[model samples]
Target: MGQLLVVRHGQASFGADDYDVLSPTGEEQARVLGAALADLAPDLVVHGSLVRQRRTAELLAAAAGWDVRLREDPRWNELEDLAQFAAVSGSPDGLDRDGFQQWYDAAMARWTGGEHDHDYSEPFVGFRDRANAALADVADEGTVVAVSSGGPIAAIASVLLAGDATTYGRLLPGIVNAGITRVISGRRGLTLLSFNEHQHLPPELRTYR
Candidate 1:
């Protein structure tokens, strides 16, 4: 059986013109996470093609001093409907602050509820399928670390937990960026061993708001 460790990308420049880049704090977070997992010596390290996700994997590899093979897999990319939501709703920059919360909440509601069907972005079903395929590619017997975004991580966790789509929609809210979720392969299938573990970081570093 294989062990899969899913990691959400470090903090990104959310709401910036180039949201693909990671903030300075995000860089440090990735380094710290890398140090935390140094002993694991993962056999395979994979990340989404998105810059932020790839950067996180790079930073982690640098910190861990491991020359593990890194693979770029697009299936791990995030659900990007937020960009469309911002465009349609006229959301301003800097979602880490206050005012963006209301706009984000409304947009997330629409995105998750499938009300944004007409929006130009990946549909929920498509995102789920992509993530599931990426997870299914993991080989047995060695640890695989997949660096991805919150949405894809949640989607994978949902499948591991409930075996269907409806449960993912209802349970994905709890996942956070830079968090770790563990899945262990077994006779039955992938078993979700943990979800959203961030105890390695201090209180100040833990931010899902």
Candidate 2:
């Protein structure tokens, strides 16, 4: 049996020119989280290919004083459907925050309701299959920390919650930036230990924007 820690990437430059980079405060938040986890000494560290996610993992590894050996898995990346919707809707660059959110909500609702096919984006079923496969691969004797975005993390949690896709839509918004969720592997399967933990961070460091 093993333990899996799912960590949301620290705060990024939300509503900025580029959303892939971590903010200065985000780096510090990662460092603090690293310090909090140093004693645990996880066996494996994984993150998505996105720069913000990778950078957070790097910062955590540095703070823990460990030589980082990170594995990048695209399956852990967030949904790209919103980006496609934005493009399709002819949203202008850098000023479509509200529009993007609206599109995202509608797309997610459609996704959860099984109205969209894989051609639309990474469908819910596909996301679950790939994410579960990745989780299964990492279930071992030691702890594994996976750094990812809100969407994937929420999907994983939704699966763990043993509910339908609609539940995920209701649960995702509650996840805070840089939050931690614990899932333990056991004889039966993976069991969720905790969800969206941010007790280690002060209020100032918990901002998602």
Candidate 3:
């Protein structure tokens, strides 16, 4: 059986000018997670092409002291949040955190509801399909670790667990930054062993954003 460990990128610069970059806390989180992952001795390390994802992968690899070259894959990148936000009406971009969450929730609900097929940046079906394909392509014989965003990580988990679109939608908000999701693929096919683990991080280090 081959092991697949999917990691959500550390906390990003939410609400900042460049949201693709990781925050200082995020860098620390990645370093801590990397040290723990080093013990696993992953045969391959992979990440999406996004800046935040790439930075997380690099930081973790360095902290782990693993010399493996990271495999860049765009299919593992996050769904387009700006596109989703634009699809909805009423510019809640300037709203407070609580207000924004409400607006964002409604927007996500509309997206996952399958109402706007042509409206999304990347159609939900395409996103789901690509996520599955990416996972299959990286199923190495030994342990494999992939650093990506929460959306792709959750999408893959939802598929392997036989969850529907609603399950996938529900998962996005709960994934902790720098959390790990483990799976095993063999003749029997992919099986999810764990989801959203961050026990290695202290209370102050845990975050979701």
Candidate 4:
């Protein structure tokens, strides 16, 4: 059985003008996680096409002293719904944090309802399909680590566990920054071994945003 470690990118610059970049805390979180996972000796490391994801992988490899080749795959990218959310909710520009979360939750529901597949920024089913395909493509005969966002990681777990998008959405809030989810692929295909493991980080380092 080959192991696939799906790692959520570190805490991003939430509420910033550009949310794609990693914050100072995010860079530290990635380095700490890399040091923690150094002994795993992953044969390959991959990340989504997002800047945050790529930066996380690069920092992780540098900290871990792993010279493995890094690969990029857009199929593992997170489900983007910011534009769709704005379209559905008249924009959350002036909303507070809680208010923004409220809008986000409702927007997530609509996106996953399978109704706006035609016009959503990214179709929910297509996202799920691509996440599954990315997981399948990397589960080779060695340890593989994938750096991604919470949505794609949750979607992967939900699909492997035979659940629906609701389950995937439910997982989003709990996935810590730099958390790890383990899966194994064998004769029976992929099996989820663990989810959201962050014992490597202390309470202060653990972040969800």
Each candidate's TM vs. the true structure? 0.84, 0.90, 0.95, 0.96
Candidate 4 wrongly placed segments (more than 4 Å): none
What range of 10 consecutive residues in model 1 has the weakest lDDT sum? 163-172
lDDT of 2: 0.81
Model 4 gets an lDDT of 0.90
Expressed as tens digits, the lDDT of each residue in 1-209 for candidate 4 is: 89999999998998799999999999999999999988888889999999999999999899999989899999878777787678765798888989988988888888889987776667889888888899999987489999999988888999988999889988878999999999998998899999999999988899998
In the predicted model 2, the residue pairs found to clash are none
When 1 and 4 are scored with lDDT, the better candidate is 4
lDDT of 3 at 63: 95
Error of 1 at 123 (Å): 1.5
lDDT of each: 0.81, 0.81, 0.88, 0.90
**What lDDT score is found at residue 36 in candidate 3?**
89
User: Residue by residue across 1-209, what tens digits does model 3's lDDT show?
Assistant: 89999999999998798999999999999999999887777888989999999999999999999988688999999998766666554577678989887888887777777778777777777788898899999886478999989889888999988998899988888899999999998989889999999998999999999
Predicted structure 3: lDDT: 0.88
Ranking by TM-score: 4, 3, 2, 1
Candidate 3 accuracy as TM-score: 0.95
- Candidate 1 residue-wise lDDT, 6-114, digit = tens: 9988889965888889888788888988998888978999999999999999998889887899999999988765677877777557665567767876666666566
- Among the numbered candidates, top TM-score falls to 4
Best by lDDT: 4
Candidate 1 Cα errors over 4 Å, as ranges: 86-99, 114-120, 139-141, 163-173
